[model samples]
Target: MTVSPAPREHDVLTDLLTQVGYRNEKAFAELYRRTSARLFGLCMRMMGDPDDAEETLQECFVVVWHRAPLFDPRLAGAMTWLMAIARNKAIDRLRQRPRTQGARDIDWDALPDTSPGPAEDGENDLAYRRLSDCLGALENRQRYCVRDAFFSGLTYVELAERMQVPLGTMKSWIRRALQQLRACMTP
Candidate 1:
């Protein structure tokens, strides 16, 4: 099962972020305590290697520390915004290397060890379950493609080649898949 790192009740995180923006070390430490594992798992999945994931996670927080003052809650909730930074960091790390044909097909056999595993019932878990259900509604190819692309940071062209489809076809598939996800995710 897939899971996210942080929960969405981010009003407190927003307040903490405001403090971090002003260079409050305690708030930053608290932020890390709440979200680090989740972000580490995200980075691990994207990088597909534990070491790289750790590095990316650290870099993500460093950026967060510096950029907290620039955060705008009007744009997204705190965890959402923070995870975006983590995602971007992971993607950047992935893009730094040439795409290897071998890297395209990650073993989908089991969940990665780095993940926090199943979560307890709560807002984050509820949101997690909702996303899982939406993903479950997807066709196998669409579901796999979307998950693979996001987790692996593969470009559409790379995913197309890996899936043995044309680039446009892959793009269309992912786009439609994302649209379905949006519809499913809407409350």
Candidate 2:
């Protein structure tokens, strides 16, 4: 007896995205439910203010709804495409902000310390450096695939097509690269 493999998360997201492209409200709702928190976190990191992040997240969904029909799974994965939209929206918001010529004279002690403490910031910096090193250790193709998939927002199918490799092979390369990174990151 043959047992079928469980659907991967990207595959489920891909299906939901396709349904959303058909203007299915239920699919859009489900997609929002599944991805909003992740996208919100991304927005928060980019915008650096809760209010701005909230606004950016709202704008992102609006664009997502209007552009869902343009999503092509062959070109990018659902999450990748969604993230690209969110990133672009955040950038647009940033660009619209009025530039200040000089730092305003303000009492620094009056403001609350919303940012991370020095120790925490150091840890975060160290983690980033470690991750960069781990990525650099990957095979050239695997590194390229991972960067394209997560940074450039390319889908596995798109990566495969661009790299002239089978989809499964591209997936395997990324999976193994991630595994290696995980191992390297562990203390």
On lDDT, the leading prediction is 1
**lDDT (C-alpha) at residue 37 in model 2:** 80
Lowest summed lDDT window (length 10), candidate 1: 114-123
Candidate maximizing TM-score: 1
Please list all clashing residue pairs in model 1, or write none if there are none: 5-38
Local accuracy of candidate 1 as per-residue lDDT tens digits, 148-187: 8877777898889888999999999999999999999999
Each prediction's whole-model lDDT (CA): 0.81, 0.75
lDDT of 2 by residue, 1-187 (tens): 9999987667788899889889999999998988888788767765667998899999999998888889999987677789889988876776566643211222222444343322234335556579878988988888877765654345687678878999999999999999999999998
TM-score of candidate 1 versus the correct structure, residues matched by position: 0.78
TM-scores for candidates 1 onward, in order = 0.78, 0.55
